[model samples]
Target chain A: MPSPADKTARPTGFRVALRDARGHLDPHWWLVAPILILVVCLYLLPLGNVLLLSVSDPKPGLDNYERIATASGPLKVLLTTLRLCAITTVISIVLGFCVAFAMAHVRETHQRILVVAVLVPLWISVLIRAFSWLVLLRDQGPVNDWLMQSGAIDQPLALVRNELGVVIGMVHYLIPYAVLPIFAVMRGIDQRLLFASRSLGAGAVTTFLKVYLPLTLPGVFAATVIVFVFGLGFYVTPAILGGGRVVMLAESVSVAILQTVRWGFGAAQSVVLLVLTLVLIGIMAKTVGLKKGFG
Target chain B: MTDESAGQDIRLYGLSKYYGDFRALDDVNLHVAAGEFLTLLGPSGSGKSTLLMALAGFVEPTHGDIFVGGSSITALAPEKRDFGVVFQGYALFPHMTVAGNVGYPLKVRGLGKPEIAAKVRDALDLVQLGHLATRLPKQLSGGQQQRVALARALVFSPKMLLLDEPMGALDKKLRHDLQLELRQLHRRLGRTFVNVTHDQEEAMAMSDRIAIMRAGKIEQLGAPRALYDAPETRFVADFLGKSNFIEGKVTGIDAGIATLDTADGPVVHALGTRPAGIGDSLLLALRPQKLMLGPGPNSRKATVETAIFLGTHAEVSLRCASGLALALNLGIENAQALPAEGTTVELGWDPAATVAVRPD
Candidate 1:
């Protein structure tokens, strides 16, 4: 019924066009596809299920998210979690900068020793580190025993079962995580740049501030975002070190799911945490660039 | 020739540099006059760059002092020494625009915004790069970037300018063009420029005087013409240009010219400063271009081994004896009657054309 040109154009042209489009796609797209499918099934689908449950469980409505904004205690919990994560991120990034700078220029033998020290903490279980901190900082524990022995204090100090203890444990764990990315960036920087600056008449401190600091800012931004995101979803360190006293969003979500038997409320809290992490990450990606931000 | 206006006296006294057990520079001593362009010419690993680095304060000499204008600068830092350095790779800041890179030294010196802008504009204009002031280093061509480096080095109008193989990265034609331009610029600026290069032609064309160095020592140092005409050693003669070496014994001396008995014949050499007794073995350096080919007055008979016809001239390789060979250039005017290969021809040169040089 059709002419030969029209008949060829119908299927063969479409087939060639599709083939060209497929060729234009990145060669590594196949490797990326399986991971993307896994993430959608294991992470994205579950997250979407939580969002649906937060609104539709028991009844199809936005009642649970509404309660988050309206209820006084839930709003306070959200604010506390945000504030704690911000503080922990700042503290860890500062400590990480010093450690990374030291590692970047240290002798090879000493650098190996320092690397082992940092990685040793990473390999130790998070629960074990929290327990160790609790033992050291608890009232009438070794810290109080030392202070009483030194006669600096008349009574035991309140060190554990509080936000201070929780922040301390969190920073200790997150600092090594922050150091690696920043150190990688610092090490790759050309040392001649500093020499060039000095040759151009800049003093040592000025050269460090003007040339060295600006180049490493991307690494700092990356470390900050990563540490903050990891801190947001932390549970064990806060639970064990906070001694069930200071409540964070993750610990609160666990209570809602287990103790209150309110799956809707727990899912709502999780979805909020996930949304907050994504928002921070999005802003970071746009500012410092995606590769350096993740690096 | 000495000029009274040239007073930027640079003195290096017993300067030596050692890299552990290996000596990079021996006890090197040199004096450069003001407003003179002196080139440290040598092959790689010959310590020419090391001498320039020492002068620029990038390298610390192990055993001596560097004096600029009769004041020692050994303890001074590079910036404090106030000598501008143009590196081999140009080393322009990749992130900065042309104007920004040129203005960096001014900005570091705490110059005002308007002053830096004006100076940067003038410096770029001097190098004919005013139009590309806003482009980044990577955006410009290699020649353009090299010009930027030169402008950056000269922007501050320092007492001395140190250039370490500044034209090493350039293409041949570009390098030739830039060489003439650079010599003109040097004459106009009248600043002391101490350049390091292994390119012999570049040194011949650019330097007011060249210091030919080998094995961490100065083999010869003189004006370009003086060095070419009266090279004191075999290394200097071979390094400055092509030369046909004829080894023999000094048989006679009349006035300052000495005559040597060689395989080809008795070759007379102009002995300007060197003195040699009779029976002393000598090696004479005869320049190829100085040898006039074809039969004429003062011509010697030789058999042509190879003849290459160049555009302007032809190079004829002739054998004088069993093991002696001489290269002679025949101008295009004489190329019409060029001798065929294996043909005998007469090659001629003036009586005082060659110089007696010390064997390496």
Candidate 2:
């Protein structure tokens, strides 16, 4: 990379006066300096304090971190979180891909309606959505009643207060996240590529697999990063749906903080979630960037 | 690209495609001979592209039977039709490399990797883009991307190649160059090509025959020179090129020559004898180049209105005594000599140059 001074070597190029500005700060930074400072003080300070407490409180050291790595309790919570998030990501991506694909090809007014329908759920609070799912999936709910009345099931099935109920609520909450990104990408794809593929003697299935699917990988990768990260930090949905039976990472962190009052351990778990989400995004960004250009 | 696939003759019987009440292609019938390069030439909404798409099996005709090599393919799927289509916008797979795109048809045909790679190399070489095989479509220039599309379409050597405005996005120089290259390739491959374009110059220069369409119907179909020389209708003459309409009444008919009395004076149309009688009003389609400056069999006294110097020729506007305006393409030699605006001069042409047509 060229040095900053070299880049601004021509006076007309930048005229930043890097040396004269306060410790290399551009004069333009002054306009947003107050807001930037406030963001750091209010937002980053709390986040940094959380990380600091993970190692400082209760005699400090790596006690909370060691427990996260070695103890079965923290490990089990992490495992459950990872497993459920993976399942939710997969299901949401598959279902959202279908919705987005349909939206991409439909008529203009119909596509508008579909886009609103997909995004409207996000406006509804996750708490309300989770309760709705709980009501629908629990024993003696309408679904179970219908199944029993149809003679399909002898009794109400175990649907709520478990992993299944939690996944249902999380997938519902995460679906819009999956759909919007994928839909945006799918809409930009030229429909003629499909026709061109077909005319080149590739069948519909082959064209979808080879041309359409590859073109959509960037969107899928972005959705996976979003749905998975959002699934990790999800608090209310899992709490309401899990009913204290299927404890996940966020729920465990809440217990350690509010009930057991282990702020250090909770903060440690929070840092773990932050690191995991960042690492996933980092990995996804590489592949997404590689396939991002499609014009 | 292959000896086994020379070309296939295509026949469309009473093809009609209707969207609600709008007729995209109304009662169209056409026969393209084997190994012929035919162009469907028309302006937008004239259904030229629609006809090409129908042949490619992308657009199904509401009522028609399309036969290729004497076998009906009206119900065949686009993939099953085995036609190489170079779509408008090229539609190169952005995710795939150039070589991958060119190899796609062969890959779908289950060709071995070695054979596919070799053939892709040859196809790229055919378009003279072998070195850019590994680059993605977005990385190439527009003309390069167009060449890649051509390579991919011709890679598998399908029975025919369909191009929908293949040069629609190109500039004039590149379009002319590609037109020449495409024509040479057609001769080399001996494959039937059905191209759709609104550019009349492209149609005239590259096509073995041109099918001029208007309002979902073929206005005229013939070889380029034949169509230009003897357009059957005013629309054909106007759309294919610029034409000056002259109204006249047939005053005499003798010895296969018809003398018409125009407002300017008497003129003769000795090209050929047509269905005409004395005192019959007629419309003549006279091309700009056909209108000469010297006296000839058909002569008209006119005053020059304007003369604009173009590279090859100067386009002069003339208003005859009848107040009928005509455009003339004067050669550079005459353009350099003289004749200022409003200068009165006698404009003449061979009687054969004036083609009689219906007033429409």
Pull out the clashing pairs in model 1.
Answer: B8-B34
* DockQ score of the complex predicted as candidate 2: 0.79
Q: Candidate 1, after superposition: displacement of residue A187 in Å?
A: 3.9
TM-score of 2: 0.91
Q: What is the C-alpha lDDT of each candidate?
A: 0.85, 0.89
The residue-by-residue lDDT of candidate 1 on B1-360, one tens digit each, is 344224266999999999998788999999999889999999999999999888877789999999988789998987787677778878776667899889988988899999999999999998999999999988998789889988888887777778889899989999998889889988988889999999999999999999999988899999999999899999999899989888878899899777878777777777676788899998888888888875554467889999999989888898886468888877888866778999887777776777888898
B13 in model 1: Cα distance from truth in Å? 1.9
Say which docking band candidate 1 falls in. acceptable
Give the deviation of candidate 1 from the true structure as CA RMSD. 6.1
lDDT score, candidate 1, position A8: 46
Q: Show where candidate 2 strays beyond 4 Å.
A: A1-37, A289-295, B1-3, B263-266, B271-273, B294-303, B342-346
After best superposition, candidate 2 residue B30: deviation in angstroms?
A: 1.2
Over 4 Å off in model 1, which ranges? A1-44, A67-74, A103-161, A246-261, A279-288, A292-295, B1-8, B243-272, B284-354
True contacts kept of each: 0.26, 1.00
Candidate number achieving the greatest TM-score relative to the actual structure? 2
Predicted structure 1: lDDT: 0.85
In angstroms, the error of model 1 at A286 is 3.7
